[model samples]
Target: MDTTKKLPLEMVYHWESSSPDSLYMTQPIGHGKVVEYTWGRAVNEARRMAAYLKSLNLPEKSRIGLISKNCAHWIMTDWAIWMAGHVSVPLYPTLNADTVNYILNHAECDVLFVGKLDDWDMMKPGVPESVRCISYPLSPSNNFETWDDIVAKYPPLEGRVERDPDEMATIVYTSGSTGRPKGVMLSFNNMAFAAAGGIETLGVGPSERMLSYLPLAHVFERTFVELGSLYSGFQLYFAESLDTFVQDLQRARPTLFLSVPRLWVKFQHGVLQKLPKEKLERLLKIPVLNKVIKKKVLKGLGLDKVKLAGSGSAPLSNDVLDWYRNLGLELLEGYGMSENFAYSHMNKPGRTRTGYVGESLPGVETKISEQGEVLVKSPASMMGYYKDDEKSREAFTEDGFLKTGDKGEIDEMGRLKLTGRIKEIFKTSKGKYIAPAPIENKLMSHAAIEMVCVSGANQTQPHALVVLGEEIRPKAADEAFRKELEESFKSLIKDINKTVDPHEQLAFITVVSDEWSIENSFLTPTLKLKRNVVEDAYQARVDSWYAKKQPVIWQ
Candidate 1:
C-alpha cells in the first residue's frame, strides 16, 4: 500500500495558515484557571522553542527526553523536538528514579524537558547532571533554564521547518508489564500515517474536541490525540489532575473520549454509589424517566456531550460496556498495542460487537499464528525496538507481520476477540494450562471487585486475588456486610466456574490487603498487572491460605 510522507510538523504548518486562530489546546493551570493556546500561538511557541533547541547545537537526530503529564507544553515540546531535528524520548511521570535514569542513559539523551509532574523530586535525581534540563511553566521548582525564558530569548524559527518522513521521531518505551521497558523507535511517517489513517477512519475533523488526560508518552495518546490534533486541527483539552477530573472534563465537553477500563469501572461505581444498581436498573425500565436519569448521570460525570467514546489499554468487561451503552453513550472497544501505534483494530459506530474489539481497520492485515497469537501488519507499525536488535527481530514473523503476543479469535465477519496474553498462560501441577485474563475479567465485572489477578502456577487448581472496590472495602468491616459480600463472591465464583472447563476452575479467591499501582511495582503505567511480580509476592502464602480458608480467603 502506498502512503504519503505527510508529517505532523507539516500538518502544524498547515494549521498555522488554514486556521491560525482556532483553539488548539486548553491547559488547566490549577485554582480554577486555564490557559488557551490557539493554532497560531501553539505553532509560534513551538517554533520559538525549536529556535532555542537549535541553539543547543546537539547532534542531528539527538534523543531529547521529555518527562511530564498531559499538558499543552508537552505537545509543543514534541513539535519543537521534530522542528529542531531531534528525537524525543518521553518517560512516564510516575516512574521511579532507577527507571527514569535507565531510559535517559539508554536513549543517550542530550537534553531533557521537565514538565508538570507530582513526583519531580523523586525523578530529578535519576536525570544525569550532564544532560541539559529545560523546565516548563508548570514544572516543579528547579534551577534549570526555563521554557518561558527560552521563548522570550529566541525568535520563532525563520521558516516552516519540514521533516523527512523516514527520520526517527520518538523513542516510546513500553510500559513494561513484565520486565524492564524497551524503547520502541517510531519514524515521522510512522506517526503521521497512524494519525492520518485514524482520523479518516474515525471521521475526526476540525470540529472534534478531545480531552487529553492519558499520558502522551504512550502511543495511544501521542498518535491518536496529539498527532490526531495536528492532522485534524481539533481542539485538544488537558485534564489538570485526578482530583479535578470531572470539573476539567466538564469544561472541555469533548465530542470524543477515550479512557481505560479501570477508570470506566470507577465511573460505574461512582454512579452506583449515588444510585444503587437495583434502583438505577429499575428506573431505566421506565422509558421517559430512564432517559432523564441517564442524561443526569452522564452530565454529572461530564460525559453527556460525548458523541464517540472508547475503552482500551486493557480488556473492558462487557458488563461495563453495556452499562455505558444503556445510558445512551456509544462506548466502543478497540484493540491495539504500543508496538502498532494503537492503529490495529477498532469498532465502528454502527458495526460493533459486544465482546469483540472490532474488525481490522482499513489498510491492515491480521492472522492467527500457529500458536494462537494474534499477528498484525499495519502502515503505522513501529521502526522496531530501539537498540535492541534481538528483541526487535523476534517481534515479527519472517513475512513481517508483528507478533502482537495476544491470543485471540477472529470471527467470520473479521471481528477480533482477545482471549488472553500468550505469555500470561500458566500451568498447574496436574499438567493443565490455564489462561487467567478471561477468568480475571469475569470477577472484574462485579462492581464490588476492583482488580483481580488469577494465579497458582504448579498448584492443583488456579485461584485469584482481588482488591475490593473503594466503597465496598469500608463496608466489609461490618459483620453483616462481610457475610453478605462473602456469599456474593461464592455465587460469582460458582457462576464463573460453570462456564470454564473443570481444570480451569478457580480453587479459591484471596482478598488482597493492598492495592496494586505503578508506585508499588504491581501494575504497569498502562495498568496491566505485572503478573510475575504479583505471583512472587503471593507465592509464600499460597499453600497456607488454602488450608485456612474455605473459598474466599481474606489476606
Candidate 2:
C-alpha cells in the first residue's frame, strides 16, 4: 500500500469540486425525517465555519475541542477545524465532568464546539469560563454561539489553506479502563496512510453504503466512518437515536458494517429470542432449508446487504464468529490500539483465521517482544502521547517498535492470537498465574451471561462474577427461571472446566443483579469492562461466595 496520499482536507476539497451534487451524508433529525448534505453543501458549510474561526485570530495550530455524538455537523466541524489551521481534540459524548475537564485543560483548547449530546448538564461544569464555545444543531443550556448564526454571519473562506502531511491533525484520547486517559497525537500523514491502507484492505468504494451509529470519538469509528467516507466517497447515514437504530439500519442497507463484541453478542441474543438455538442449529443443517433460514435471519437483522462485517475494539469469541458464519456472514476480527490509528492487523476477506487477528497490513510490521508483548512498526503509528515525554519514550523500543502491552504469540502463518493483557494476569493462592480473558470469553458464550469477570488474586481458585443478559433479568424472580439457569450454568461450567488447566478452573459463578454501564463507572465509553472497578466493587464478597459451597451463587 502507498504510504503517501492526500490528507483529509485535500480529499474534502477534491470531492467538493468533483462531486458537488453527490450525497455526502444523510442525518436523521426526527421520526421519518432526515437532513441530507451534498458534498458541495458540506464543504461550503465547513468553509464558513473556518472563516468564523479565522476571524477570532487564534494562534496558529490552536487546539479546539469537539464533543458530540455522530452527526453530519460533527464531521463538518472537524474539517473546518483543520481548514482553519487548528488541532482537533475529541471527547467522548458520555464522558463525566472530571475527565472532560482534564482533557480540555490538558489539551489547552482555545475553543469548544458542542453538538448533539445526551447529558449536557453533566458536562457543562467541565468547560472553563476562559474557553470560547460554539454549539452545533443543539445548543447546550449555557449561552454560547450557535453553528447556524456563525455560518450565516461569515462568508465562506476563499482559497484552501496549505498543510504539510506530517503536521498534527488531532489528539485522540484513549478510553482508559485503569487510569487517566492519555492523548495520542496523530498527524495528517499518519491518518492518510491508515485511510489508504484500510481502503485497499477492505475494498470499500464510493458506491459502498454504511450506517454510522458508533461514537465518532473512538478511533475505530473515526477512521472507518469519517475518514473512510471522505476518501471513498461512500454515502454515510446517521442513526436518529438508540430507539430508532433498527429502523435506521434497515433504511440504509449498508454494504459495510462494524461493531464491537458486546453489540455482536446482543445481535445473537436477539436472534435466539425468536428461534431457540437448538432449533436454529438443527434447521441450519438442512441443505435447502438452510439457505432460506440464513436469508430470513440476515434480512431480519438488516444486514442482508452487508458485503463486509467486522468486529473490533476488543477480542471476539470464536463461538460468535462461527455463529455468524453459519448464517453466511464472514465476521472478521481485527486488532489495533489508539496508539497505532488502528492500522496494525486485519483479517482479509476469504483468508480469515478463526481465532487470530490476521496478518499485518501491507507496510506494517509486527513482532513479539522477549516478554511476549506484541510490538508494531507502521506508518500509522502516532507521533507520541501528547505532553507526556516519559510515556512517549516508554511506549517505543530502542528499535522504534511500539510496545502494545498485550501478550501474544505469532503462529507459523504470522497471525497474532492475543493471550491477555500482561497486567491482567492474576496469581491464585495455589501459586499459579491465570489469564482471565480466555475464561471470561468462554463464560460470555452462555446465553444467560451478558458480561463476566474472573478474579482470584490470593484466593483458592478463580471465580467469575456474571451479569445476566437483558432477556434473563425479567424472569429472575421466578423459581422456574432459577432452575433453568442453574441447570444451564452447571453444564456450562463443567464443559468449560474440561478444556482449561486445573489451576484455571473456576470455583463458582456469582450472578450479579446490577447492570454494568458507563454511567455507573463499570464500563468505559467504548463498552469495555473496567476490571479494576469490577474487582474493587466485589473483592470483599469473593470469600463469602466461596463459603456458600454451591456451584452458583446469586447476588
Which predicted model would earn the best lDDT?
Answer: 2
lDDT of 1 by residue, 318-367 (tens): 88888889899979888887788888999999888888999898788999
After superposition, the stretches of candidate 1 with alpha carbons farther than 4 Å from their true spots are 1-5
Clashes of each: 0, 0
TM-score of 1: 0.98
What TM-scores do the predictions have?
0.98, 0.98
RMSD of 2: 1.3
Task: State the lDDT at 508 in candidate 2.
Answer: 90
Question: What tens-digit string does per-residue lDDT give for candidate 2 at 1-555?
Answer: 232478888898889889999998999888599999999999999999999999999999999999999999999999999999999999999999999999999999999998889999998899898999998875446578999889999999989787888999999999999899999999999898888888888878899999998899999998888999887889999988888899999989999999999999999999999998999999999998999999999999999999999889999888889999989999988888899888888988888888788889888999998888999999899999999999999999999999998999888888889999999999998789998988998998887888889988998889999998898898988999899999889889899999999999988998999889999999999999999999999878878888898988989
Error at 482, model 1, angstroms: 1.0
Q: What is the C-alpha RMSD of each candidate to the true structure, in Å?
A: 1.5, 1.3
Evaluate residue 12 in candidate 1 and report its C-alpha lDDT on the 0 to 100 scale: 82
lDDT value, candidate 1, whole model? 0.89
